[model samples]
Target: MKTTTIRTDLPREEKRKGAFMILTFFGIMATAGFLAMSIDLGVVAVFKVRMQNVADAAALAAAQEISIALDEISDQISSGNVQGEVQDANSYAQDQARVMAEHVAELNGMFIDPQIDVLFGQRTLDENSGEATITWGVSPFNAVKVIVRKDNPSQTAPDAKVDLFFAKMFDNDQVALRAEAVAYIDSRDLVVVMDFSGSMVYDSLWRSDSIDKLGQQAIDDGLYNIWTDLDSPTYGNMQFDNDWITIPSDSSSSPKVSLTWKKSTVDITTTKQLDYARLYFSDNKYQNFSSLSGQSKTLSGTGSNSGKLIKYAKVRYKENGREYYADFDLFDYDTLKRGLDLNGVNYPYPSGSWNSFISYCLNDSEVNRAGYRYQFGMMNLVHYWLDAQMPYSSTPELWKTRHYPFNAVKSGGSLLCEFLDGLDFGDHLGLVTYDTYHRVESQLVPDGWVSESVDIGATPITDDYSAIDTIQKHKQAAHYYNTTNVGGGLHEAIKLLDEHSRYGSQKTILLMTDGNANTSDNNWSVPSDFSWNAMTDYNGDGVADYTTSDSHKLYTFVRVKQAIDKGYTIHTMSVGANADRDFMKAIAFAGDGIWVDVPGGTTVAAMEEQMLQAFARIAANVPPPKLTHSESP
Candidate 1:
């Protein structure tokens, strides 16, 4: 120990030992630095983990909120009535977005201005593609990549990736949410009513080049095409004019014809109240005008006496098993060229008419030769044709016919006598006149010749007699006025149609018209003093009680309401410009039907195609109503 102390004093010489000490100190410092780095790295790792968890939660929360928002959006869109309201949708959507964003921000302790930026809605979903798009706002980072798609996660991938912190590098972060959805709108119910009336026949104006400047080819072609396709057995067809007639493809089959006269009469009155019933319900103006407009709310006398009488005669002809003519008979080339000389009122006949008329007797060519006039058996053939083509009372006016002028003769003008003569009574067909006019004899000719035995009575006799007399009188009044009543035809046809229909089958209606309701001196009721320019007889007295304020509008209201009440999905088409577009539109709007306006300037082929397309559209949109046993009843 004494020797060591002596050496320590001498170490003052060893003061140059600074290098070794420095080395030792530096090594200690290096180790401390390594430890400090390990601690800092650990802290960074923890922060990363926390950030990831927040991102996951935020994304999922946004996704769910968006889904709810979509549901709200859909409800809002469909909430408004047909009038169409929209701002409500935007408000609801934005509210939902804010709530979702706030909740996410609270959980993560991150600042965010969560909201939805409503954009103009201009896009429509591609239903076939199953795709939708939506626009939204961005916050914090200004922009980010995201896919806003439908909520059907089932269609999404399980390992989908969503970046939450990528935008954080810009010192800004915000949860952006989006979603898309689709809802279906449907309109599906249909009813079709087809018109089968006498006016469907070709008139001289529809044929003559002089009067019919537009040409007959169009009408002829269109009608032919339409009729051929409509003749299918799968659909319902009725032949109606002032009455209902069933033209069976198979003569032996029970014709699917409804006797509207009887049915309508029965619907309004029974045997006991016939005479006591308000022979005049509402005043004449109201009652008559109402009937003409297809309203007839008061249900005056049973069926129109004229309609019933026609039906009676038709039934007789049917019972006798007579044959009627097809519509094409009046247009044979030869018969058409021969021209009609109705007391010097020369009129060109359509070639097809003559051909059609002859179709009842010999082959179609019998009337093809130039100046060919089949007079020998023409009356018999015409009678056969008349019997076969009996019209229904409710047939649409477009389908009815009145004065069928053949060979332009003043004769062959009276359809009433022709109707009765076609019956099994042979020449006794004139007996109906006898019943009405009290005739002892039955010899009446078209040339104003009456076999003394056929002309007996003067005063009106049976109702049937009176009805025929009306037809005769109409035939003599206005040449064209004698044309058929189409609405009446449809009414009759519908009645007959019910017979063949059973419950559960689809019921459809297809109505075709050439013009509006027939207008005659505006007298829907008996010609009275007040109704010379009045509308209705509300008092039920025979006088004109109601004046037409909006009678024209009433036409649409009545027709549409009637169709709707019957549970029919109506489809209406105008044959030409002759129809009232406004009225047609009203009818279509009220019944949810289609209004097809046949172009006036277009070619017949084009017009027909367009009409058919319209028909197809109607057929596509509406499913027929399911027939019920009560529907027929």
Candidate 2:
């Protein structure tokens, strides 16, 4: 501003430029503040999301623990623990649930204090709207709720702060956020289908499946000296004994063994015709067989109205002057093959050395030193494969009943009941056993049902589900060791679920079997009462799965589809090698359920454990946990 040019306008223009500069500076500061606020908000939003996930996870973890706790309580109850003990178990489960939630929170980088509430309660679902309402502090807590948050000064839970990433300039350096979640399981009604067939009670030694590798074990245990058909992949014989029937001082009288070949349980009066009988003896090791060198005897009575003794003889067993268990041998339809055909009683048969007949399956020489007691033990496992029910025992050991597959069935069934008893879910359990027909052993009722004893006259299968005591009830129910009728069994189970299940509750069928489903028009056919009807278009094709054929009329897999159509899921367990695994698996798939295959163990305890674990898995089976409430509280 030169004095000569100095003017008010010039001064005013300079002032305007200064004003613009100040305004621009202020605008820049405001824009920076807004950007910082956005970043802080974004960080907080992302953090809240992360915390929400942690809450959801913690809730689910705790809920899973709830299931385990239920199982524990169930176990204690099943083990005959008293009410006070059961309460203790429940308390333990509740504590463990909290522990699990905290563990999960820690895993997700959350450090929630123990004082923070991990709520246990009940959750109910709306059938029409599918909306769920949660009620906290309910008994038999079935639902779990979890909460999480960043540190807060006023909170009872541990306090900690999360500094904002960009809002510090305004004097606010921290942010607060919280999240909550809830989870639960629905109730269920279960019907158990079991098989009680005669084969279940058959001798394990007669098991033809590769699973029964008892040959080596038997040899090691020094029980058998001769195998009827050695190393054969399929056969129903493998029972032998060491005691040789003493040849009565009179040689003409043969030591005869009688076999009962009638099934009393069969509806029809039928008898088996004995085609032929074979008597085996250890010629080389006569420790069990009396050496009858140069001896001969005649067997007279097989003692069957429809059976006949074709021909029987005993002669000197000298292998070209080689003296064995006897100086002579038995030459008949069932004796040593001596080409010479010395005895007049000697008829046409497989001719060769005494070893010739059994050469293919021969494996038992030094049985005395093979171990065990008195040169042999655990014998008498022979039964005629060519016929039914004809068991040829050389001694009194035949009277000892051997329960192979049936024993496994009862043992495993008991274990299943034990598992169910532990749930404490108040879930109803019913039992349906099928042999020639179906019998409802226990109805779907609560435990400690006094009506089981008093009201039994109304129905034979009116026993209540007495928690673990159901084991004995199961044993008694499974007493019918006759022929299998899987279809009839399934039908009865389905009927039970259909008629007695609670409304709005989950319905399930647990079918356990030891062999193939009994088909029609064969030796395995069930009685007329076992007739079963089926209905299902399992493949979704236009054609129905159930047809007029016997196979279709039987439950087969159509029953699984039928159950599914009725909103009932089916889980199957196949016990022993004889169980029809493929069919059972197909049923499980169709019914939207699971299948478990358990081995037919040698010992009852071993089989019991396997069966118990299997049942446990089935009992614990549940849909994946979902977030009923996933929001900030």
Candidate 3:
């Protein structure tokens, strides 16, 4: 017992230190466990987000496929192929949905192995309560619900499983992830009314060969002969005089052929050529004929030579070692002379006709081949650009027929088809065209309307392929016609939308034109004087109406107001320089829509881009989704 208590105290102190060390070690182990758990949670969260994205894409794919299946079912029923049985239709829809989901999922990511569940149904939301409900197995099968799950034991095979890195320490090696999406075939009634006016037949630029050189040579050689034929007492009153005509030294640059004549009794050899030629006619004498140099006029009028005049005039002349031909207006020269004299300055002398005739000739052969033709206006550019974008599959026959001559191209109708080809599933499209009259090229129908009959202008079908096929076929057959009837086109489009569009669907009209409302037939009630018949009634009231006039513009405006009042959106596109941009803008403004102006002289690529952007904007402006219910539970 001698000092042993002291030794016991030291041992007790060592034991206490050991106990403290054990507590510290345990605390460290607990902290590390929590850190591992956090890291595992972060990894799981990343996988979960990725899986959700995959599921979203897969669900969309499945919904689209189901929509297509519904279209097939409708076709079968319409064709008397499918008997009265819902199971067969549902089975086909389920199979297609599963297949499409797996395909899209595989494309999105490699780690996503999902089980897709599809339900054909309708989703409704109570406006008063803000509550949404889904009714399954609904008739018409306009909606599809897609559930995508990974590692869900209750789901079918090929469930998605994500491996754990740090959570394995807690005896968890993997985690299951799931997501879902629902989609409905939004019934969209769209009308695409394009211009098929006579201008559409022209190319963007004409070839240099379009000039009628042979006709121009005849004019140059026969102009004086015609003067000789106009016999009168005043013809010889000025007396016959010495005259000499000198061809221009540099016709390409100067474009002037000097004509000098002397009436005075002077030495003919000493008389100098007049600095400027003057033509003495009945009441007026035209001076400074050089002013006529380089002018171009389209040859057209009521005359025996009208056919010859409508094409072009070529004034052939020789300058330095090159032979050149210039464009000139030969037919109706008297009328042209009067028009040029209206200003009372810059008169067209008889010599000025030659000078003016040669003014437009570019001596450079390359320029002649590549120079832009004025007759081929902005509308042609739009058509050419659209033609360039068409697929080879759709262009073979068109190219051989329409595009081969003068390197001409198809119209904007093809571009509309190309756009339709890229549309999302469940979008419905209709086609219309306007010239002298509005023609229904194709009726409004869902994304899948591919019966052969549909392609041949029959009513829209509910087949297995894309509605774009029917639209494209119709567009290919479109041809240029005389006159622009925007009112008629819009009227037909609105009527189609009003009559055939499904309830609760988005309605749109795409009105395109290259010109103002200049043409009106008996159908539109516009008088021959191009004036609005103010007394005609538009609203069916017996009284003569002042509110609805009878001009093409008033008719179009009335239709636009009606469509707007009915909640229809209209998008207007002015395609060419002739297109009345202000009119189009007003129409779009009235309809609460957008106006797209592709002005003249822009590149083809620019035209295409503008058109595509307009369509994209309209598509994006759809009403917000009615109800999107997630299948999380």
Best by lDDT: 2
Q: Score candidate 3 by TM-score against the native.
A: 0.38
Model 2: per-residue Cα lDDT over 19-58, one tens digit each:
8998999999999999999998888888888888888888
Q: What does the lDDT read for residue 337 in candidate 3?
A: 29
Name the candidate, 1 or 2, with the larger lDDT value.
2
Regarding TM-score, does 2 or 3 come out ahead?
2
Q: List model 1 lDDT by residue over 302-336, tens digit each.
A: 43342221111111112133422111112233432
lDDT tens readout by residue for model 3, 1-633: 555434544556766787888899999989998998888889878776776676666666666664454344332222122223223554566667767767776676633333326565654433234244556776434455655556744323456466677777878777777665666545456677767665542323232221222232222222222223222111111222212111122235554432111111111111122221223322232222332222221112223322221222223334454544433322233322221222233322211222232222213232234332211222222223223322223222232223211111122333333333333323456767777777776543333222244442443311112454344443322244456788889988887776655555568888877667876646544234332222233344554333333378877876676676688988888865456776787677666677777553333444444544444444333333232445311
Off by over 4 Å in 1: 1-182, 185-187, 203-511, 519-556, 559-571, 589-594, 599-607, 617-633
RMSD of each: 28.9, 16.5, 22.5
State residue 314's C-alpha deviation in candidate 3, in Å: 22
Which stretches of model 3 miss by more than 4 angstroms? 1-185, 202-422, 442-480, 521-550, 612-623, 628-633
Go through the candidates in order and give each one's C-alpha lDDT.
0.31, 0.51, 0.46
Each model's TM-score? 0.28, 0.51, 0.38
Candidate 1 overall Cα lDDT vs. reference?
0.31
